[model samples]
Target: MPRSALISALLLASLSLSLNARAETDPWANYDKVLKTLPKDAAATLDRGVSCNHFSGEINGDNSAADKQTFREMKKLKCGTVDQDIASVKNKYKNNKAVVNAIQVYYEN
Candidate 1:
């Protein structure tokens, strides 16, 4: 390959690797960022209520360490068990697209 092409290929490879690494480390980081922007009360409510939905995703298999930590945090918040809170969070996500989208992206990751 030409030198320029080689450089471009290397850059693309690096980006792919970084993205995959990020995906493996914390699938929910993007969503967490979205969650962070909510007002304290809303964030707390939503997190307490919906965090288990994210945890459910983990149980399904994504298995990111960051995701596990997020679940731990949610548990610490004294939210009801994962099943109890999941529906509530899903309702919030349906009502709040921005936050939900962020969380969806995390889940998608």
Candidate 2:
């Protein structure tokens, strides 16, 4: 390959790696910072969702319009996307009522 083509390929590879890394990061991972912005009930619900499994399953699907909007709002609040944020929260709280509480908190807040 020509030197210019090699440089271009390298640049593309670098950009792809960076984007993938960023995408892998949970958007709602920073909820702790925004926890203060949430109401007592909302905060509690989030805590609950962090502990539950059922709600977390629903969250994984794209059907929750309210949840989607909540995810969008979370981004503005620096909370990131809900789908990304819920993965670990689900794992951490799987089977716990906290999942329901968290989803409620996410939508209500």
Candidate 3:
């Protein structure tokens, strides 16, 4: 391969390796970031509400961390997931960017 192509390939490989290592160390890091800066009021509400979720909003924490693929994992987790387009969600978290796609609370009695 040409020198330029070899450099590009190495860079790509290193980046992929770094990402894989990060994920393995903290499988729930993305979720943590999305939930990290929740305002006291909303966080409290979530803890108290019968059903709660952060259905839709952009995440500005770490671009590489929040991704479309994460949605699949979100669903598989022991947490409720909801459609991102719900009006209640939109209105509730209109300006918040740290919101995850969805995370409905399933309180166990």
In terms of lDDT, the best-performing candidate is 1
**Candidate 3 displacement at residue 99 in angstroms:** 26
lDDT of 3 by residue, 1-109 (tens): 9999999999999999999999876535554454446665444444333223332233333534564444444454322533323334435786765432323322222
Each candidate: how many clashes? 0, 11, 0
Q: Which 10 residues in a row give candidate 3 its minimum summed lDDT? A: 100-109
User: Residue 4 lDDT in model 3?
Assistant: 100
Candidate structures ordered by lDDT, highest first: 1, 2, 3
User: Alpha-carbon error at 23 in model 1, in Å?
Assistant: 7.0
Q: Candidate 3: lDDT of 35?
A: 44
All models: lDDT? 0.61, 0.56, 0.47
Which ranges of candidate 3 are over 4 A from the true structure?
A: 29-109
Better structure of 1 and 2 per TM-score: 1
Model 2, span 34-68: residue lDDT tens: 55555565455465444333344446455479678
Look at candidate 3 and give me any clashing residue pairs: none
Please write out the lDDT profile of model 1 over residues 5-48, one tens digit for every residue: 99999999999999999887774555567667865544665555
TM-score order, best first, reads 1, 2, 3
Q: Which ten residues in a row have the lowest lDDT in candidate 1?
A: 100-109
User: Each candidate's TM vs. the true structure?
Assistant: 0.36, 0.31, 0.28
Global local distance difference test of model 3: 0.47
